[model samples]
Target: MERKTKLALAKTATLLAAIPALVYANASGPDPGLTGVPNEAGTCAACHGSGTSSINTKGGSVTVALPNGNSYVPGQAQHLVVTVADPTAKRWGFQLTARVAAGTSTQAGGFKSTDSNTQGICSNSQLRTAQPNTSGTCAASVPLMYVEHTTSGTRLGTTGSVTYGFDWTPPSTDAGKITLYVAANAANGNNQDDTGDHVYTATYSLTAATAAAQPTISAVVNGATFAAGIEAGSWVTIQGKNLTTAASCDAGSPRPGCRTWSSSDFTNGTPTSLDNVSVSIGGKAAFVYYISPTQINVQAPDINAGDVAVTVTNGNGTSNSVTVTAADFAPGFFQTGRYAIATHQDGSLVAPASVIPGASPAARGETVILWGTGFGPVSPSVVAGQTSSQAIGSALAYASAPPNITIGGVTATTVGAALNPSALGLYQIAVTVPNGAQSGDQPIIANSAGKTSPANVLFSVR
Candidate 1:
């Protein structure tokens, strides 16, 4: 078993070594290239000139004079175009095909691609005998050397060249071959039929690879989250296993590699454009970017109302989803004398908390306690209707103020305004029964920000 394994390994290595480095310009055809009779003489010059050749092919013939070449690169969208001549049939035409080898055709075996070709077209034929009138375009999938586009004089012309070649990313080997055939038909001006086996051979080999790999996409993360109210031009951080990775893409590709976290990548991948409020971060390998993934930092991007979601794709077979909300995120509630209001974690007043106890309008003294969180400092305030004229202490005095205060509907007069240090978490503003003030589940408003304790001051004036 060990000996057999060694032999197999040896065979594989030998096979790979036989493969050439490149293929493109190393075509096995005419020396310099046999596009027409004038090009044929150039083949002989290779032996004379620096790197020239005199291999040429015209009507009814196909020629290749190179000694070595390499495989065709695939993603590069590489391809070839050739013209052949079929001099036989009363009406003559030609067929074209391709053959690919792993090595210099001498060492490793070759494989024939069976894909459709777009380069196969008739150059000269009986059907095209009217000088430049060629019919039918012959296309095939490449990586293979086989005869096709066998046009009859009735459907084609003679005396011209049949063009064929390849289109694909050539493999990383050299032993590749592209062969062509010329066939004539009865309609050909020659007035005779050409056999099926008529063909011309041109073989060349190249060494090592002159190309590189195709753009391969990769991501480090799989998804991200977005806050509501998409702010245009914000770089929404996206995480995925390959989000930061860069794909080289094809050389012939119109789109070059995208910036690591470009919006184009996400928009192009998905039919719809990325939400204006979001975008991906850029990098390579385990890519990284800043976008809210989980609990938002208190100092980080502000939270908004409504839910938002994001989808991140690595473009290499993986993706995931992220969710967000529009509701303001708060750590605690606000104080309004047991009647509280909703505020965001940033401590800004939000939804007003409904007054409870459901009592009818009151006209005298009453007390109210505000409840919630983050009441760092107590601020002075006044109701919409009453001004300094409704005096009752530092809380609210009408300068011997006659009007009092209203505590959640029950009117009252300020007994005293309790002022505590900013650090104090709670306070008790007390008031006495008073007249002239009326209310129905009305609120005891404040004039300052961040004040929550000692809800309302009440007083009385008989």
Candidate 2:
């Protein structure tokens, strides 16, 4: 019995050896550039449909699902899935490419395979090859890239439909618009030839997301009082939309909090722009200090008193010019809510202890320093956009005229009134609290150059 079995096996081996080996084309992967992209050969149908006009038959469909609807943010990555479906299909495969909508031959972004079921192809105008690395990046000379199925991705003889997933990163800058071209095959699983397969082609158009609206100025006001009007060398606050691009602290960005211009942001002079955000007042750039989406703090440039056009320019575009009255002196006191921002000689804050942690009310007869802006020009006038610098004892850059300051309706003795030497557009006033000053919140007002500080401001006194 053993000898008979050996003879049968030998006869079977001889019969197999006598037959020709069957070769299957595209069993590993299709050649490059078959995604039906513009200027490319017709989809897999060029090789899979037996030269018949039956390609793109009605029984099946190819679709691409994008995570971000029909718009893409520049430099953002999106996961995508390609699905090929046919009720009678027993195998599936697909290929896809993204091209700039303006010029279909130009690549729009990059595609990378997310799993073993897929692979990437890099192609030049004339030739194509497998991507050299997992990043799916192509050589600079070969700028076009495509993503398609690997051999195992075919799922031969096991499916009525199949889906492949990959990731696509949009260009770092807006590319206008983009289109994805995809071609898919739903095969019969015969493995003998490409005759009985269905070919499908689809294209998806995506637009660059509309950018944040250009900055819009709703109001231009004193940075200290939030009142309208501005003055040269004054701290001005621009109230607007889309003033800056930094995300707020609550927006989940990876910084400590909202962006504030730091010392490093200055160069030879104060930065006139921050994070590509700039302000032009009367056609002169303002020195930018703090920036946020809804507000910007800037030191107004030196300009004559008159109506001037104010505008903000940022990454998106320029805002509509808003006219604002510019004056030589628009005096304002920096305040914490209704309380004037004041400090004792030792630098401790003067406020209701409950208003600020570790704060105490100012004592009668004590000398308190008050902070403000827009006191107008001083002697040895400091250049706009430059830091204020003056020797403390040599000569003080005092206001053109000593400001008349009254607290609780009683005129206080003003000892010092000048621009703070260590800062720009900032002024400090030294005053002696009245001997008979009443306790609790006291109205504080400063009048300079005939302009009065906002009337509602007050300070805590005891």
Candidate 3:
């Protein structure tokens, strides 16, 4: 079964089982019971082997597995098993055609075949009972059924009792239906009939257990993960924890109980921190030890990337951790794109400026492209005049000028200006060369900067 982490698609898992079986299934369902064979598969091999869907019950319960190779081959050596317990039956043993076909029932709960003439036998216990006693010569796969057989190495079960157990590679999905239809004789020898008043089928239930509950995550967290990281006026949803916001949890230290968030499980989102965390009925509250959010999606902080424990508030007390990362972030900035972005001294970064081809010192009413690292991301104010001495004669430095910008009051300043030219971070600004200023092929004074642009690259005003 797939565990649900709200939006999570994958999960981490761990579980163990004792019986492994290979059941034969034809279009008609479980094939007829096989009996009296000297092999690791016991008597079940006659039906489970070769071209049949019936799996041998000799090796305990054999798991019908699907491997990396989609197709199964002939004579392939495999580990498998099967198990049955009748507390009141004469004794315990692996499933045999005798048992399956006989529709044998325990006196009360025992599997002892009154026919085996054996008495006081125990039920199957995984990995404990290693050996099973049989009255015939069989295949190598046959002996494996009595894994607890004293000869195998360790007898994990009671004396004279047989159980199913073997190493298994397991399967991708443990949530499907498997059927057992082979028959066993109640009296053991030469019985082809499934004769017994109690002859019937049993259903094995499937479960998604404890081992598959833990979550796997990957993400970036910082104070930013907790809300605007002190920049916003207030409030931010610290996202993480396939997480929730309200629940019986703790916060770190003096602020113990209910609010501690770990740096390792946090992330930033549209509004930073989340609100209206569900305290009940499908709330956004997540694990506090992980400081995950039920209100928002969070990723597991990488141990290699220097993730720290900011505040782990679980049902227990709050705690802090200094280190958690196993390594660090994978190499490269502008990781997938064409730009070669690097850190600069001003703390401001940008993409290559958008350069305007022409239009400076125009006669009147004309557009000029003002190119530079920081250009009009949105509509911006502009000023034009004769080139001032500060200008480089041939160029104008397009800048953020006077007032800073804001997006409908949302402050869209998360990104900084990258002054790389190859990336062209500049833009275009236009204005008249200014009615009566100095002419003579002089550089135009782009905006209010008193900078002198180059003379040769100058435009003429009528």
What does candidate 1's lDDT look like per residue over 66-147, in tens digits?
A: 2123444322334444344455422222223232333211112222223332222222211221111122222222112222
The count of backbone overlaps in candidate 3 is 128
User: 70, model 2: CA deviation in Å?
Assistant: 13
TM-score, candidate 2, is 0.56
lDDT of 3 by residue, 1-462 (tens): 344663253322211121112211111112212323222222433332232233222222322223322221222222333333222222222332212112221111112222222211122312122233332222233322211211221122333223343322222333222222222211121112212101212222222222211112222222211211111011122333433324334444312223434443245411123232221101222222223433222222212223333332333222222232212111111210222122222322222232222222233322222222112221121211112112233333333431121211221221322122221222223232243444333332221222221212223332
Q: Candidate 2, residues 1-462: lDDT per residue as tens digits?
A: 999999999999987775433223265556667888767766888778665377667488999999879999888888999999998888778889898999988888888889988887787887445443468567787888888887789898876689999999888899988999998888887764567788898999999995456678899999899997579989999987777665554443433214667777776568898778899999999998877888889999998899999999987779989999998888888988778899998898999888888789998898999999988878767778765563343455888777888889988889888888778888999999997788888999888878889889988897
Count of clashes, each model = 119, 0, 128
Q: Per-candidate RMSD vs. true structure?
A: 22.3, 16.9, 23.7
lDDT of 2: 0.82
Q: In order, what lDDT does every prediction score?
A: 0.29, 0.82, 0.25
Q: Deviation in angstroms for 371 in model 1?
A: 28
lDDT of 2 at 413: 85
Worst 10 residues of 2 by lDDT: 249-258
